[model samples]
Target: MWKHFKFDPNSVNFSCFTDEKFNKFDNLLRFEWEHAVSQDLFMFTIDYNAKQRILDDGDLNYIIGLNRDRQEKRRVPYLFEHVNIPFDNKKFHFNKIKDAEVLFSLDNEQQTDKHLIIINAAPIRPYHVLLVPYRELEQPQVIERNNLISIIFPDVANPMCLDSLCDLLLGQIIETKYVVTADCIVFGCEFVAASAHPYIVAGLNSLCAYASVNHLHLHGMYCPGRMFIQTLKCSVFHTKSNCYLLDSFQPQAFAFEVKHIDEFNKISQDVYKITNYLMLNNIAHNVAIVKGDSFSSADNVLRIFIWFRQSITNGEKFERCNFAFLELSGFMTMPDEKVYNTLTESEMCQHMNRLGLSVEEQERIKDDVKNLLDN
Candidate 1:
């Protein structure tokens, strides 16, 4: 018989419940813990008010949350607010490192076998587990020979880094299965709240498999986590086939291409022009142009990816004053298409010029966008 680990939510100290168990939710074996028990161990909860206090320099040694019924409504437990005791710091070591090797390892076999590693960092999600790569690569943009091997070590460091790591990993995983196919990569980003480390937060971005960069190492998907979530408000429709745009009021979107060294020579100018255009327009975004020669294998097509906010809301205030829940998750507000269409050819050209793109290269991108839209 397989042993199942269980935890009691009401317990004051639930450190003993970190074992693996059969989970009914994912239909696969996973580590399970009681919400109350985890609260006791981590010395915090996903409560926005609590996070705000911490961010304002309040003591973070303890926190409280509403019962399930009051969670969404943000109702206070008038009777139980003072009745339920907060977690005690004496029972746990907040600063101590759990097994560092397990938390940060390059070997896939070693990482897959170990139970999740809980770090001293603030928990972004309930039971947030961070896995760090054993070996640290120099410079975030450099591609390693073994793309898969590279991600294994770094995915755990933090969310900001995880976004790029995810892009690379996704591409490699897809290429290993389908050698030749034109796949589209889609990416998105949102924020996560942190109470313990109030100043720090998290974001997530992901892409589909067909996207590729020419370099053997560049063929994988790449994504990174950010500290904030920016969105635009417009009626944006969703489809699995063509790419969709989320219209926003803020200039928070950005996109870039990834190409193999050989393919880079073919589309480098186009990629440069696009990046220059976005940056010169004062768009708050990131563009990663990965080289194929940096790795053993490379994908042919250059991956053009972009992200911008469609809207921005007072998530922090709502979570704290109203919901008491963490403002980690964001809602997508689509923007007006007419606003995006207002950009004139000359206006775009001027933006490109700011990025130092020559007139000839700007014309090429303009021709390319026009052709893309015409088709």
Candidate 2:
């Protein structure tokens, strides 16, 4: 199914890194990513609410005001245009780049023309693949199926169209399947306008995570963290299709799911809609994406999850509170061991609560998203 997948860079095309020589190299990527799980970093089914299970380090401060991201602006404005975009070697634009190192982007001709892949310089997990679109200058506004934000993306066709050199990056999708679980996050339009290159980030690892880059990207990490231990599963928002909207059982996060690969692009639609909702209401927000289901498995279900956190107050933004994908989905990767080791599950949970969308706001967002899917 993957060998024939589509890679469309119109908005953001899906393309596999089709190199017979890299076949073995691709396996190496999986091996390194799986090492995190081999170390047992993934969280499986367990009760988080039970006092005995949550945490014991009550003496340590939860670091509710933890502002660890040095790469991002401290006082982030609600729109992408408001922040001061970073400057690169004066010869190049900050995020607007034609070619870059493979780690930063598909920085070469062979890689760009065929299997365009960019590895993260300092990735949250090994083998984090960002499906990049080369045409950053052609920012055409695509169909606005979303009621909220009018997201611009490459036009979508089937996932297996071969006309495009890079139809899909199987490494990203396969990596997700190998782990059985993966986590991801988002940086909506305003979240990182300084870096205009658009891409989707997916990895085969995770627990507590963060969006370290402002360049528009998607995240795919492994497993739900301690924070997503109790995700809300509501069917009221279910579409006629198998797709359903999953709000984090916890208070701070909201997510929607499409159950088939055919609807994978729809995940973008939901994200744009939700981001639009947040923007329209003057609420600053961040979005994230985690692989919905294992593509390699017999489940035959391709689940794609799009989650967003609503920071409705200036205080929340001023606090530099990052309620992006990883945090909302049940984990927050602390800046250092001092914060990570000292923070117990309970404290982390408390911090997650603080970063989430309020109950009423979540409901409103869900309603709007549901309307988009049902239609």
Candidate 3:
């Protein structure tokens, strides 16, 4: 059994997150979120007050959700124009929780150090929170190969990272319950593990990828939808494992699937090896891990999608539509109402493809990654 936070909805003081059974996490999250909203704890009240539409262009079902309120909040002066901002230069960090409410404070559990689960101040959805590991260590947004490897290997593993991923999946499974409508019909409800109710763990490696804070943290949003990346059209790229290149997707990405925990170590290594290379080369990237076969009644495989794109070195202005891990995964949040209203599928495709490497360059990258892992 995995450890879980002993959560309390009424406490302003820290609640201990320890090794308990993982049955009540979804209930805990929802309870506290409602409590926080009652106390007016968030920077903004983000009730589903935005325009949303879904566009199916043959291969992908694109969710175009516009959050006009969030767009207005981004106009703050401290917003920088560069991806590689120094830690000391930033006016904002997650070291201290402000405006948002804390759900739980994780102590030493399974040899994992301190961590925090705090609500997103500018939340995009209910139960949206940020998970910060080793808060005092003050790690940056960039991924260190050594640190990543330490998390994957059991001897030196920081299970907090892996546990966070599993928590999202497990929470989805546990949230299954029976509901009755006013019409007096009984129905079964099972939320999609990926961003449906509990949360999906997503990371943005640089500002170009819409990372607002330099401090190391992961976003857990309750985005409700079956993302297209969960089951993307793919052609096998490397014969070594379940590695494939997303076919016909803009900004070519490598997708790796992990069917069980035993396969996690090797799969994470392969995924991070490529990410490390991208970090060293000053390439911006986004990572999204979701239930691979989310739509299937019996499948529970997890898929890791990594996209390497052109770094936004100078942040003079934002991209036409900021493409982060979530956007790349198909659940897009358009801050600008105008862009959200007028954007076409073909135009969006062209823009995202241009943001990534050319077809020849991506082919070279594929070859390079295959060689790196094989040897």
Clashes of each: 50, 41, 2
Give the candidate number with the greatest lDDT: 3
Q: Which runs of model 1 end up more than 4 angstroms from their true locations? A: 1-96, 100-120, 131-202, 205-241, 252-375
What TM-score goes with each of the models? 0.27, 0.49, 0.72
The 0-to-1 C-alpha lDDT of every candidate, in the order given, reads: 0.24, 0.35, 0.58
lDDT of 1 by residue, 57-143 (tens): 222111222223123333221111111123333322212233321222111133332212233233333333332222122111111
Please give, for residues 313-365, the per-residue lDDT of candidate 3 as tens digits: 54434546667787777777777767877777677777667677777877777
RMSD of 1: 20.3
Candidate 3 TM-score, true structure as reference? 0.72
Model 3 CA lDDT for position 339: 83
Ranking by TM-score: 3, 2, 1
What TM-score does model 1 achieve against the real structure?
0.27
Greater-lDDT candidate between 1 and 3: 3
